[model samples]
Target: MIRVVLPAHLRVLAQVDGEVRLDVEEPTIGAVLDALEARCPVLRGTIRDRRTGRRRAFVRFYACAEDLSHEPADTALPGPVAAGAEPFLVIGAMAGG
Candidate 1:
């Protein structure tokens, strides 16, 4: 299972609490997101584009304690996440004026 941690707002929107676990055949960030969306349809458009299927502007991905800001679509996630040993945190990026 791929553990997922949702931001407070997203959790509230999806009416889910704590970490969510998903099963993914392929160990990629894209696949994980797909599973997340499939499991929680209410969070579909909140994290990624509904049409383009791209990650949202304020959404960020992290793994292996590194920032995957410019990673390609096919980039493989960390071993822990890929092996379903660790969670791919889905945190909401915060901004301020």
Candidate 2:
């Protein structure tokens, strides 16, 4: 099971509490997001673009202390995250002037 940690807003949108555990055959960001969206259909357009399927500008992915926001969606995550030892963090990036 892969553990996913969502930002407060997303958790509220998804109506979930605490970490979300999912089974992913391939531990890639794309696969993980696919699973997440499948499990929580309400999150379809919140994390990624509904048309382009790209990561939203204000959404960031992190795990094992690495910034994965700019990484390709197909890129595989670290072993600790894949093994459920660490949480895959989905943070809502802050932006301001």
Candidate 3:
């Protein structure tokens, strides 16, 4: 199971506490996210758009050294995340005027 740490807002939105664990067959970012959303229905629109299927503008994913910002759709996620050894941190990027 891949460990996922959601931001506080997302946790509140999902009505869940602590870290979320998801079992992924593909060991990819997309797969991990899918499992997360599946487990927490209220998280559906928070991380991604219901129709567009894109990462929400405010949320960002980080793992090890990879930015994964422009990575291909099929790009494999970090090995630790894949192996469920480390948590995939889903943080909200702060922006200011």
Best by lDDT: 2
Segments in model 1 whose C-alpha atoms lie over 4 Å from true places? none
**Cα lDDT computed for each candidate against the true fold:** 0.83, 0.96, 0.82
Candidate 1 root-mean-square deviation in Å: 1.3
The reply for model 3, stretches above 4 Å from the true place, is: none
lDDT at position 15, candidate 1: 87
Q: What is the C-alpha lDDT profile of model 1 across 3-94, one tens digit per residue?
A: 88888999999889898889888877888888988999999999889998888889888876776755766778888887767778876788
Q: Candidate 2 local accuracy as lDDT?
A: 0.96
Task: Tell me, by TM-score, which candidate is best.
Answer: 2
Order of candidates by TM-score, top first?
A: 2, 1, 3
TM-score of each: 0.90, 0.98, 0.89
Worst 10 residues of 3 by lDDT: 65-74
- Give per-residue CA lDDT, model 2, range 11-93, as digits (tens): 99999999999999999999999999999999999999999999999999999999999999899989999999999999999
lDDT of 3 by residue, 2-97 (tens): 888899988888888998988878877788888998999888888878898788888888877557655554678888877878788898989999
Whole-structure CA lDDT of model 3: 0.82
Count of clashes in candidate 2: 0
For residue 45, what is the lDDT in candidate 3?
82
Clashes of each: 0, 0, 0
